[model samples]
Target: MIHKREFLRRNLPYDGRIKLASYYNSRHVRVPVKAAQITKAVRWHASLLQPVTGIDPAQLSARSLRAGGAMALLAGQCDTNTIKLLCRWHSDAMMRYLHQQSLPIFQRLSSKMFNNGSYTFLPEDWVPAAAE
Candidate 1:
């Protein structure tokens, strides 16, 4: 994807303003994608994928691609700083983009927390069963 963007940047004539996400218009001129065009494309593709993916076309938008990329990087164990740089996030605001932190991460954290604190949430009136 980066290589494709770079190839478009170097090859396309855009008066020194290269757009990473662009398409050739019907007139054969490459132009930057507008917001509406991106939304339309996302919806169109989602509709096509709905049968196999079972994803609602209405649930996807241009922003879904950004969040999905960030989630993919997080799931791959990429460092937060690298994700921030790649996502062009200026601050810790990038954390908000990671809304769906997976259950495994939470489970790992919970185990670590309980072990470090020497604590458990068992009921006070409960007792261990006899070995049988």
Candidate 2:
């Protein structure tokens, strides 16, 4: 994402190039990231996490973890296309889960009434009286 943004910025023929580092340095006293450091940092963070007891960390790819996270979000009622784009999945399984979970909530809310038999409204209670 950052690379794409930077590529667009640099490729545009402006009087001055908007280098990402300069943009960051201008905004903050300490620059948080440089494009060159992104890969190493991503790999280092991925390496630092311990794998599940039965799973090997080396065998796990970031893409797979992202897809699993997207699935979990769908199961929890997140918008499917948004999660799909975030996870970069090609299938509609996430959308199906979201719709299935949401249908029950919609049905329950639709069946409920604003007032039951125990409540009644009188016209006097709502209308203002005229003075003679």
Return the top candidate by TM-score: 1
Query: What is candidate 2's CA lDDT for residue 54?
Result: 44
Q: Per-residue alpha-carbon lDDT of model 1 for 61-128, expressed as tens digits? A: 88878878988888888888998899888898767768555566667778887796786556766667
The Cα local distance difference test for each model comes to 0.76, 0.55
Scored against the true structure, residue 66 in model 1 reaches a CA lDDT of: 80
Give the per-residue lDDT digits (tens) of candidate 2, residues 1-132.
453555466584343434444433443333545443644554556666644344444455544445457667755666767788876668875554455446665565565654433555675676557877
Q: What is the lDDT of residue 40 in candidate 1?
A: 90
Candidate 2: TM-score?
0.31
lDDT of 2: 0.55
Tell me the spans in candidate 2 whose CA falls farther than 4 Å from its real position: 1-11, 14-47, 51-55, 85-88, 93-132
In candidate 2, residue 57 scores what lDDT?
Answer: 47
Name the weakest run of 10 consecutive residues (lDDT summed) in model 1. Answer: 12-21
Angstrom error of the Cα, residue 20, model 2: value is 12
